[model samples]
Target: MERSETTATTRLSTWRQVKRMKLLYLLLLLPVVQLFIFQYIPMYGVLIAFKDFKVARGIWDSPWNNFEHFRTLFSDFIFLRALRNTLIISGLKLVFGFLAPIVFALLLNEIRHVRFKKITQSISYLPHFMSWVIAASMLVEIVSPQRGIVNYVITLFGGDPVHFLASKTYFVPMLIISDIWKEMGWAAIIYIASMASISPELYEASDVDGANRLQKMVHITIPAIMPVVVILFLLRLGNILEGGFDQILNLYNPLVYEVGDIIDTYVYRVGLVEYKFDYSAAVGLFKNVVGVVLLVTANLFVRKVSDHGAW
Candidate 1:
């Protein structure tokens, strides 16, 4: 048949093109090998979740406990507390932290003055490059009750000096606000780049129709970069179980643990601090499985709502 001949000819042409680009394929080999060695090879460690893993016996010789760890995890109060905290913290982060970057990008794009815009942007994202350790120290100083600037201001206003970090009422808000402040401008870079790619002709057409800056932003700019926004949201959703481990670990104290403790910190305390490796590994596996399920469901939901989806 003519169709069979055309298919054969197409395959031959594709083969020739690939032969021309063989060096690029050679360049790609390094990362493929690294992915296997770093990401894929370590996955066998998940077997620890199913085993009563002893250090002396090693993974291979460790006897299978068959689902006992999982059974205990569901019944355990500590594990349940970590799970609940992870959900609450991560959900609040998605609610408040998600839109900060998008809003930053939109506001930045409206700045017609080039020099001020550049300086402001440089300062805004600077905190993102700082390690959480240094940031946490600075945050503690700012919120410290005895001699801190925040308390000094409160005293000036005749209000009582309140310890922001130590309070259950204020701890989560501090976390959210600090997180948004640190990461907003850095994350906004994506939306800014997407906005830059929009054709000027559309804006020109909008100008012809007497559209204002805000109107153009809502109708022209936002719609154009929505696919990028949705993709980033989906990726962030997939990592929802993580709950900003490094930030919380650096900033939180025993006093705040009742409100601030999450899955990663819980895992650290269980596995490293208490040396319950098998139990910690099971918790980690549960986190990853939930992440995967959320990712798939988000993908499905996005597909129904819009044509631009991860699929």
Candidate 2:
């Protein structure tokens, strides 16, 4: 009888706590519902990957093909080349692009002038809002060998104009540099917020020890944000195959396909253009499986080292 009373009291306490936070929970409902509808429901369609998918038969009625597409995927040179390019681009971006935000955040944190810092941050943020279509078009104009600003500068230096986007020599670097330019500022916002939450008392204590700004930042700010850095890096590692599809699709041409083609663009041509949905789905599912493996592995590694992870 006493145990039953205790259980009843615990249930009542839980109900009261929920009632107190009811509005907040209500606010969370929309996103949870949307995720179930758009994200979770669509996952059922992934079964088509293992099936001989047909438009008429639909995802459920499709006959099971059982890894035939995957077999073809492994043998195909075109898919292999796309996979190679995707890894190379994604790896380069991970190195440069991931570091960019942390560097930008640190630089912004150093600026003493309020108005100037705000203006600089605002300008950096603008590129992230622009669509890749518009941004890539502008980028093309900026690098055009015939009449672009970059070529104009080269000629000013008595050098012949270079086709930056077309040449494989310049293509990977261009992609990495452009990606850094587009994403660095927006990604830095997370680091900036992490920095903001750091106690000012830590800096004040460092000042008393005769620490210089660089020393204090090194010891205090960077260390304070290491967890955030570790978590972000782990997340990036998980998506190690996500070479920027829209950006490359817009900017790259046939000339640079050897260096620029990625799984996404390859999938686009196969699925949408050629109407090979099953093959495309299999490739996508393969990429996603690889990503999940990487994510889990990275998470485990980070947790072991620093005790910081997505969990």
Candidate 3:
């Protein structure tokens, strides 16, 4: 009888605690509903990957074709091309785009002037706010062979005008450079915030020890923010197969497709434009599965190397 009374008292205390937090729990309902609507609900479409989906039959009535779509995707040369380009572009971005933000943050942190630093940061971050469509249009105009400022400058220097966007040789480099420009400043914001959290006393101690600016940066600043860098790098590895779709779609032409086409663009062309929905779904599912695997592998590697991980 005494043990039962004790149990009832514990239950009453738990219920009172939950009742006190009811307002906070109610506030979370919207986000939970949004997640269910936008993320979890759409996941049902993954079944289309296994079905020969027809508009007339609809998703539920569509006949299952098993692995036929997967076989078709593997046999297609274009799919292979898309896969290869996706890897190459994503790898290059990981190397260059990933480092650009870190460098920018370090340089910005070193600036001593307040007004100048604010102005410079504002200018750097402006490009990130522009839509890819607008940015790509501006780039196209700037690189136009006939009337562009770039070509005019080339002509003034007695050099041949080059069609940068159309040429296979230049397309990949342009993609990498433009991607870095678009995202660098925005990405640097996280690093700058991390740097701000580091105690200023550390830098003062380094100064007292006769360390130069570069020395303090190397020994203190970089080491302090290395955790953020590793976490971002691990997250990027998860998207190794996602060659930026919007930027590429806006900038690419048939001439540069050999080097510029990626999995997302391929899906757009084959799925929506050509109406091969099932095939596209299969390709998407494959990409997602690979991404999950890569994310898990990268997280494991990071956990082994350091204490930090996505989990």
Candidate 4:
């Protein structure tokens, strides 16, 4: 009888807690439902990757293609080049893009004037809201050899104007710079929020210790936000195989394909353009598998080293 009463009390307590948080839970339900409908449900379509998918037969009725598509992808001459381009571009973005945001956050944190800082941050973040198509078109105009602003400046300086977008040698760097410009400000917002959460008492204490501005930044500000940095970096590692598909597709041309084409663009060209869905699916599945493995590895490393992980 006593045990039964205890169980009943526990259930009542749980019910009360849920009742207290009911509105918040209700608000979360819409996104949860949408995720189920859009994100989770679409995962079922991934089965087509393992099959010789046909429109008439549909995903369910398609025959299993085994590993034939993967074999074909591996044997393709362009496969290595696509893989190399994807890795190189993603790697550079990870290194430069990752650092750019952190540096921007740090610099913004040091700004003393409120109005100026707000204006600077607002202007910097504006580009992030622009569609990739619009941004890419703007970039093309700026980099055009004939009349683009970048080439115009080069010519003004007595140097020959370079074809930035068309040149294989310049494409990767151009992509990296454009990506940094678009995303650094947006990414820095996270770091800035993390910085805000840092206790002002720590800065006061550092000031009392006669620590200079740089010293305080290095000791207090950075350490306070290090966890946020670690988590974001780990997340980036998970998607190391993906080089911004929309941005790349909009920016790159066939002339720069050797240096600029990534896995996503290659998949699009092969699947939709060439009607090689099986081959593209195989490539996509490979990327997804690698991403999952990398995410798990990064999570484990974070847990072991810092006692914090994605989970």
Candidate 5:
């Protein structure tokens, strides 16, 4: 009798499991359908990179070029410059941009006045919604040698007006600063959310132990949010090759190209404008390969060192 009851119970559980799975599939049917239609369907076009990609002969009939495109891309002069500039810009942004948001989040968390904190956050976050083109125009206006607010401030302090945007030496710094200004508050939103999850009891306990605000922040708050920071930092390592293309493209001029040109702009100018599709595809493929390798390596390293990883 006991064995018969156990078998009947098992059969009932299996039926319930099948019913739940069917319900889940019904709920997910639309999103899965959309992903297949839009995302997976487009991947078939990547074959163009492997072909000579003649317009007359569709992707199916285009002759295979094998590695010829890659060879030409590697030998191109501007490709090297673009690669170097991309690395420099991305490295700077990764280091400085990453830290700025965390610092801002911490500072905002310390604010005792709710209204002041909200006002400051709102003001800082407003710039993030502005388009890159509009932001670039604002940057040009502010850094213009004559009649700009920055230059006017310098003159008021008895200093000569500096043409910040015109000089290549200052262009990278300007990009970093402007990007930080636009993104820091928006980026801090995640860190702030992470910080909020930390138990209030931890702060109270530290206070009872004679810990000051700064000490509590350093010892309690920072440690609490560190896992989120580590995860974000690891994720960022995957996209180091992208290098804020739209912002750089909008803000840069021919004079600043040597220092500010990156892979996306390079690909745009050469592939779309100049119509060297094969070469541009090769360069883009190279960047994607590096990004994939970095993501995998970083995830593995994080897992080994901290036991926290993307996977």
Candidate 6:
């Protein structure tokens, strides 16, 4: 009887706690519903990756092909080329783009003047808000072989005008540079916020110990935000296969397809343009599987090396 009364009291306490937080629970309803409708609901279409989907027959009625699409996807040379480019481009961006924000944030944190810092941050972030189409248009105007300011400047220096947008030699570098230019400032916002949260007392103590700004940044600021860095790195690893489709689609042309093509663009060409939906679905599935594997591997490696991980 004592034990039964104790269980009843515990249940009553739990109920009262939940009752007190009812409004907070209600606040989560919209996001949960949106996730279900937009994310989880679309997962059902993944079945088309394994099936010979026809519009007339619809997704449910489509006949299964038993990995035929996957076999075709693997055998296609174009798909392999796209896959290679995706890895190369995404890898380069991961290395350079990942570091850009960290460096920018650290430098911004070192800035003592408040007004100058805000103005600089605002200017940096403005480009991130611009659409890829607009950014690509601006890039094209700047790099135009015939009348662009860049080529004109080169000519004034006694250099030959080179076609940068159409040249495979410069395509990848341009992609990386443009991407960093657009996103670095926005990305640094998180790191700057993280740096701001570090204790002022630690910096004071470091100053007391004769530590300079650089030394304090290395010891206090970076260490305090190392976990955030690790988490962001892991999240980026999950997108190792995504090579910025919108930017590439807008900026790339047939002349640069060999070096600029990526999995997402290939999917758009085959699935949407050519109406080979199943093949595109197969390619997408492969990309997603690789992404998941990379994310898991990176998470595991990070966990082994440090205390931080996605989980």
Off by over 4 Å in 6: 1-14
Give the true-structure RMSD of model 4: 1.7
Model number with the top TM-score: 2
Clashes of each: 0, 0, 0, 0, 0, 0
Clashing pairs in 2: none
Candidate 5 C-alpha lDDT tens digits along 118-164: 99988888999999999999999998889799999999999999878
Minimum summed lDDT over a 10-residue window in model 2 is located at: 302-311
Better of 1 and 6 by lDDT: 6
Candidate 4 residue 222 Cα shift, in angstroms, is: 0.6
The superposed Cα distance between candidate 2 and the true structure at residue 96, in angstroms, equals 0.4
Candidate 6 structure quality by residue, lDDT tens digits, 40-78: 999898899999999999999999999999988888999
RMSDs, each prediction? 1.5, 1.4, 2.4, 1.7, 3.3, 1.8
lDDT of 6 at 286: 93
lDDT tens digits by residue: candidate 4, 237-302: 999999899998998899998888888999999989999776787899899899999999989988
- Cα lDDT computed for each candidate against the true fold: 0.93, 0.93, 0.94, 0.90, 0.89, 0.94
lDDT of 3 by residue, 1-311 (tens): 99999999999999999899999888998999999999999999888899999989988899999789999988999999999999999999999999999999999999999999989988888999999999999999988999889999999999999999999999999999999999999999999999999999999998899999999999999999998998899889999999999999999999988999999999999999999998999999999999999999989988998888888
Which digits, one per residue and each the tens of the lDDT, describe model 1 over residues 181-232?
9999899998999999999999999999999999999999999999999999
Candidate 2 RMSD computed on C-alpha atoms after optimal superposition onto the true structure: 1.4
- Return whichever of 5 and 6 wins on TM-score: 6
TM-score of 2: 0.96
In candidate 3 the C-alpha lDDT for residue 269 amounts to 98
